[model samples]
Target: MFAGAGSNLSQQFNLPFWVGTFGCAMLTILVSFMDFKKITRVLGIFTPIIIVMIFIICAYTFVGKTYDYEALDTVAQTIKSPMPNVFLAVINYYSLCAISAVSMAFVLGGSVVRIGVAEKGGLVGGTVIGLIITCATVTLFANIDNVKDADIPMLQIVKNISPVFSFVYSLTIFALIFNTAFSLFYAFAKRFAGRNKKKLRTVLCISVTIGFCLSFCGFKNLVALMYPILGYIGMLLLAVLLITWIKEKKNILAENLIRKKMIHLAVKKYDEDLDYTKKDKALFHRLGEKSVVDTEEIKSEIKNFVKETGTENLKPSEPESQSQSSDSANN
Candidate 1:
């Protein structure tokens, strides 16, 4: 971040770029070293807060200003490159601008982010809300000043309304920058932190200092170089994630279909033997009952004949009813 680089404070105080750069980066360093989970959650809310502030500021501008800007404020005067397609041009602008802005939804663990995202109708829904808010903000700020030469156009807009407003807006800007800076630096430092507390602090300082030094290269230059590269990287990551999601869904659907087919086949075989399953209830009770009754009489006859004959081998305690019951149970 440029921090207070082109703000009213820097201009009034005649501060050097290095001063603002180092100050912001150093604050970010302290933020990185903080072991506070509450701080992360608090900082996480800052982006939404920032967006709300933007909406508030936009409303103030609408109510405060009666006259229109003589001309639209253009942030970039020199259009070094141009795209022909209108849709693509808009897409390109947002893709670059959103690099850090949209990092809030990410940066946390993906699963946790997904859980949080679902309540707001998932990631795409949140994005649409963000876009609507962004469009309103752009419409207000684009005409903040007609004189496009000022590096800090928003500062001039608020200043025109009131010094009090300007000062408050400036502080808001600083807070937003600080919040964003904390996230970025902390993310970079946390990677190397692992379990080394002492080493992590040293690395964190060095990293912040290095970032401060890098900031001297100027925010405009960095944005110019970094945005396009980040845009492509973001696109690639999105493509990979979408493709993987599609593949996973396909696998799940395939497994479900196979399972259904197996169940269907098993049911078909069961249906074929449905007649056999109902043998005792359906067929045996009707047709086989008389034959079964005839067999009992025949068994009684045999038992009586065996008893009447002097058969020493057959014990009197041995019952033919037990044998017949066993046969019926087997069937």
Candidate 2:
């Protein structure tokens, strides 16, 4: 992203690529020192603008450009892919993108207090992203002959549309790149430095400087070499997470079963000990005399007991008489 942003700046301003690259790297380092809330605030401002610009660019291209259907299949077949299998290639690409956003997702998820809100956010976010990608892909493929050799294809497409659109879209693309770069580096620093502000700043300086030097490799070269490797690594990480989640769900189910059993035992004990006082009678009468045990009260008591004594000690004990009889029969 740093390389891509630098390329955008160089093309837009007619400046040396290194100068733009260095400027972007320094700006990113400065952003790393800002408070996380402020960083998110900056992102919040640009996100909607970028989204709108992307759709506009796509719409313009779709309206203005005509795709060569006959040539489309030929171009697609001739184009080289990082992965040989098309399905796996798509999976790898998406996995790489998911890995990039996973840390930010964690940060955002932490702030959500309600399951419903998180569910809605995830659904809407995924749908919008998918739509954007679909639009952009169709637009790009439509202009494949023009952009197959270009450094930044989307910029070329927008520039061809109009100078005004080109300028605005360039700024939007830069912001989009900055948003990604900032989030990635911020997450990296936070993961290693934890809550240590000083160490975080230090890591940011070193990492961004290293990244700037590496960006000298040029954008296309970096993408060609880096993305596929990251995609494979992301796939491995995703597999591990899926396995861990399955194991966690199994453990939760087992624990829930044990908890339910404990609650049932506790409820039976409570029902047996009731004195059948007026209060109990009134409760039974209100409940139609079908049952007197308050299952909810039993569940709450079991939860408290587990908190105090732990689940290891919550197993029901056998009756002493039953144990003695079993022992005599064995003898």
TM-score of each: 0.59, 0.72
lDDT of 1 at 5: 46
Model 1: lDDT to the true structure: 0.53
lDDT of candidate 1 at residue 250, scale 0 to 100: 61
Inter-residue clash pairs, candidate 2: none
* Model 1 TM-score on a 0 to 1 scale: 0.59
TM-score of candidate 2 to 2 decimals: 0.72
**How does each model score on lDDT?**
0.53, 0.71
Q: Name the runs in model 2 displaced over 4 angstroms.
A: 64-66, 249-331
- Estimate candidate 2's alpha-carbon lDDT, on a 0 to 1 scale: 0.71
lDDT, candidate 1, 58-114, per-residue tens: 676566556433344243333343445547656665565555544543445321311
Please report the candidate that would top TM-score against the real structure.
2
